[model samples]
Target: MDIEQLIALIDGFKQFPQIKRETTLFDIGSRGHFENPMTEVLSFFCNTTEVHGMNDLVISSIVSLIRQNAIYESLQYAQAHGKPQREVTTKNNKRIDLLLNSDEWVIAIESKVNHQQINPFDEYEAYVDSLIRTKKAVNKDNDLTDETEKQAVFVILSPDGKVDNVHLHPRWCGISFQQLVNEIKKRLQQHFFDAPFNKWYLVLKDFLLHLENLVNDEEQNSAQEEFVLTHLGEISQAWNLLKNTLQSVQQKAHTKLEQHPELNGILRSQKSSWFGLPTTILYSKDEMTEAVLFATGVPSVDIADDDPRNAGKHIFIQIHIQTDDEELELESIHESLANKAVNHWYSGGSKCFRWPVNELSIEGITKEFVSTFEAINNLSPLSLNK
Candidate 1:
C-alpha cells in the first residue's frame, strides 16, 4: 500500500533475475559475427530478396501501423494519395528507408536504434523535391498544385519510439517497436487458422517478441511487469504515497552528497563547480589508512597530467575510505570507467582506484567527499606536481 512496500516488492522480484540466453538469430549472431542486432534485423526486414517470405508483409504492417498512429486528417490525406513505393531515391543520394509515391502524395520512413546525431529532414525534403521534379518531367499537365496541403508523411521508426524532429516537421510521426509488434499481431490474427502462413507467422512472432524485449529492456514474460500490470488497481490505491516517498528518499540522498561541507570548501578553493559523481573515482595511496580519491571527469574532455600548461590546479581529487565490502564494490564498478581514467591519466592514474560508496549514509558519503579535498591539498597550488 505504501511506496516503501512497492519498492520492497520490486527489489525482491529483482533477486530472481531474468535469464537472457541467446535466443534470436540476431542475438546469437551478435556474439560471434555481427555487432548490432538492430541494424541486422532492419536490413533483413528491408531486403525482399532474403530467404524470409514475409518482407512485404512486414513493410505493409509497419506502414499501416504508422497510418493508424498519425493524425486522422493526415491519415485520410495519405490514404487518398498515391501508391506505396518500397524505397525511393532522393536528390541527396540517400535511399528513403520506405516510401509511398503518387503524383501528389509521398510517405517516407527512416529507421534507427541507439543512434541520435542524424537529422534526416533535410535529406527527406530533398527527396520530396526530386519526386516533384520527376512528376513534372513525366507529365507536362500534372495537376499536382496543392503544395500548401499535407502531401508528404515522414515517419521515424525506432525501438524507443523517440521522434526528435516532429516539432520541426509537422508531417513527421513516430512508430515504436511495441507498436510494430502490436500491428504484426493484429495482421496475424486476421488470417484463418488453417492458413498457409502458419510457419511464417511463428517466425514473425518470434522476431516481433525479440524486438519488443529489445525496446523494453526486459524478457518476453517479465515477471515484474506482469505482476504490476495485473495488480495495477491494487497498486494504484497507494500510488501517490509510493511515488512521493521514493522521490523524497532519492532527493535527500543527492542533496546530502551535494551539500557536504568538506566537498563545498574544496570545490570553492579549487575554483571548480561540483559536477555530480564521476563514473569512476581513482585514488593515490596515502601513508595514512584512507586512500586519496580523485573524480576523474570524462577523460576525453578533461586535461591530464602531461599537459605543458598545467596552471591553476583545477584538478578534481578526493580522499575516501574503503567501503564495507571493497572487493564486491570494486567488481560492480564499470570496466570502461577504469580503462578511460587510466588511459587519460597516463601512468600515475593507476594504483589505488576505489568506488566511492555503497551505503546511503551521510558519514560514508562525506568521507568519500572529503577524500577529494585531501587529494587537492596534496597537489602543488598552481600545478598538478606531486
Candidate 2:
C-alpha cells in the first residue's frame, strides 16, 4: 500500500497523525502511567545496560507492540570488573539519545526529554558512522588485511517512513507504526495464498464472520460505525492469529538454539567437575559476595607449601566489583575481616596469619582477567581430561 494510505490508517488510531514533515510520529497510545514499561523497553532496545525513564516507557510500549523485539542485556568480565557498557545510544539529540558504542553491531539508546527538538537523522547517521568506525578500528587492530565490517539489522522506531536504505547504508531498514498493521495484514494474505486457495478463502470468510459478530451487535448498528468497527474487528482477529504464529516460530527457534549439539559444549563448560559441583545460585549482594568467597574457597589447593621455607605462593581471585555506586566496595569485607582478626591474632599469635592480598590496576585488568580465568580453568580438575 502507498505510504499515505498507511499513514491515514495509523492516524485513525491516535492524535498527531499526518504531519507536514513525515517524521512526526502519531501520539496514539500516548496517555498512561507507563514508567516501568518504558524503562524496560529502553533498556531492551539499547541492548546493553539497564535504562529507566517515563519517556523510555512510552517509546518501549510502541516499539514492543509494533516490532517483535526488545533490548538484549549481557554481563561479562571487562577490565577485571563487572563494568556495564551500555551498548547503544541514538545521536539525534545535542547530547546523544543513544550511544552506538565502539561497534555498530549493537545500539545503546540514551535519551534526555528536556530537549526542545530532536534531529531526525541524528540517530540514523550516528548508527551508520559507528558501524564504519568500528570496522575500521577493529580492522586496524587485526591488521589492515582483515578490515571488513559485520552486518546487523537496522531499526527505527518512529512515525516516519523508512529512510532511503541505498542513500544511507546497506544495513539500514526500518518500519513505522503505520506499516506494522499492514505487515500483519500481508502475512495473513500470504497464509491464505499458501493454503488451497478455496480452503483459504473459506477460512478467511469464517474469520470475518466471527469478526462481524464482534463489531455488529444486535443493538448499535449505524452504517458508518459498522464500516469503521468492522475493519477494527478484522484487525483484532488477524492480531490473534499473528500472535500464535509468531509464538510458534519463537518456540521452534528457541528449541533449536537450546537443543543444538553445540550447546552441549556450553553446558559441559558451565557445569564442570570442579571442586565438587556447579555454583550458579542467585544471591543478594551480601550473600553473593559471601558465596563467591565460599565457592572460591571450595577450589582445592594445588600448592601445599605454606611454611616460611619455600616460595609462599597463593592463588586467589581479586574480587573486583566495579560499581558506579560508591557506597559499595570489596575493601569493606576485607577490612571487617581484618578488624575481627585484630582480636583473634592477639589471642592466637602467629597461627592465623593475615591473607596475602594484592590489587590489580584497571589498565591491564582485562588482559589479566581473561588470562587468569583461563589459568583457573586449566587448574580445574575438569581440564585434567584435556
lDDT of each: 0.48, 0.32
For this target, which candidate reaches the highest lDDT against the unseen true structure? 1
Cα-lDDT of candidate 1: 0.48
Candidate 2 C-alpha lDDT tens digits along 241-306: 534433343333233323434334232212122233222211122322211111222223432333
Candidate 2 ranges with C-alpha deviation above 4 Å: 1-42, 45-104, 107-128, 131-148, 152-154, 159-172, 178-386
Against the true structure, candidate 2 reaches a TM-score of 0.21
Off by over 4 Å in 1: 1-22, 31-56, 70-89, 100-105, 136-151, 192-194, 218-386
By summed lDDT, the worst window of 10 consecutive residues in model 1 runs over: 339-348
RMSD of 1: 15.0
Give Cα distance to truth, residue 354, candidate 2, Å.
81
At residue 350, what lDDT does model 1 achieve?
A: 33
Q: Pick the candidate with the highest TM-score.
A: 1
